[model samples]
Target: MTSFAPDSIVLNRKLPLWYQVSQSLRASILGRSPQDSLRLPTEEQLAGHYGVSVLTMRQALKELEDEGLITRHRRRGTFIEPSAQRGAPVRLLGSVDAIVAQQSGMTTELLDYGTVAVPSGLAGHFPQHAEVATYHRLRSEEKTGEPTNHARNYVRPDLAERIDPADLIRWPMTKVLRDVVGASISRITDTVEARLADPETARLLQVPLLSPILHYTGVTYDEEGQALDVAVIHYRGDRFSFTVTLDAH
Candidate 1:
């Protein structure tokens, strides 16, 4: 059994004590200090270490059980379920348009289109102060019409100046970026995280709140390593997974 140390307090500004404790335990199980099957410490021990009541600790553990992160048995105790690892990256032509074109029945729905002042966070990533053209899109596959992805993309004002929002519905942004703006994508930086779908997103995607999903934030650069665009993509967890291969030298 793995025991929680004295400093294992879970921090949550908005949640109740039990939820906070649950989140803390969940993080620990997912990260370091993981305990294998039949190796979890008793609820009393966790309660003491986290300075929470035993009932609170039990509530926390219950949440984990509901999420399938842990399994609890009457006499055998609780155990962590090994998570499924992601797969190798699918190489799209370094272009979203190319990727979409390869998928036979995928369709894009232009959700909202307009120019907006660059957010400070987004501005920080860009080299200079420039109005950013923003596009929000929902992508669905096959005849099911079930949304598989939600994307929010940002482009430099000058590059996107002549872009018609309607054109985006017909042609993917990757083509627009390359053909219309004459920019070639040279590199991309991607960051992935496991997250629960928010309320609005859950409704849009026809999934329950707290449903697991993959969140991706990426920045694409031109041949000169100048940032061309930034995008955030959310993919359905059960329907999609990614793979990346590494070469050992």
Candidate 2:
């Protein structure tokens, strides 16, 4: 009656049996298997299925519950949290989708995508005024539809004017800029800081006023050493973290 392979290895030398079993279950859940949402089998069922003791199965499930993978209720069974549905992070340099992929059950929706005149302060960042264009987008995540980020991008007007908003829903903005607009991205300069979410941003991102938010500003350049776009993104602090590596040259 069990869906899992009976002969599956339940333990390894490098990890404890409980950890090994928890990892196996985590992988299954992240894979979006139908069993993910269902109440996991009881400890007795799991022990028999994995050919392990009931104590071992309980330890494994406990570890998973602590990691937010499974939720256990009294007189109820363990169920996978919706947040555990997202598989894993897909790295895309300086992109909104990359941020969303870090959390489970999160997706991006492109709202208000279009070209606009470059702002006065921002015009100084570009070489030519005529070359600059602007794109505004609101990114939200979760099946319940909650906003996670609000972003505005300024690109070369010549480049921005060529993109269709509909295409962005299928592909990330960077892909659209590269493949559709044929802009060869070469380098990126990015900076991140903590700031308070304004009222508008709070409402859009579904965060509280004065909530700490991570603000990222990046300038992307083309292969010809031309500035292609400047992107300003704000991410919810509660749900996001940034990591980078450095080398001694």
Best candidate, TM-score: 2
lDDT of 2 by residue, 109-197 (tens): 66665556677667777746744555667765544465667778787767867888776565556667877888887767788899999
TM-score, each model? 0.57, 0.60
Candidate 2: where are CA atoms >4 Å away? 1-82, 85-106, 247-249
Error of 1 at 111 (Å): 0.7
Q: Which stretches of candidate 1 lie over 4 Å from their true place?
A: 1-104, 247-249
The true-versus-predicted C-alpha distance at residue 143 of model 1, in Å, is: 1.5
For each candidate, what is the lDDT?
0.67, 0.65
Which of the numbered candidates is closest to the native, going by highest lDDT? 1
Clash pairs detected, candidate 1: 87-242, 87-243, 88-243, 88-244, 89-243, 89-244
- Residue by residue across 75-185, what tens digits does model 1's lDDT show? 878766655111112222322432433332356799997888887888876768567888998877534566777888898777778677777776667667776668888
Model 1's lDDT to the true fold?
Answer: 0.67
Clash totals for all candidate models: 6, 3
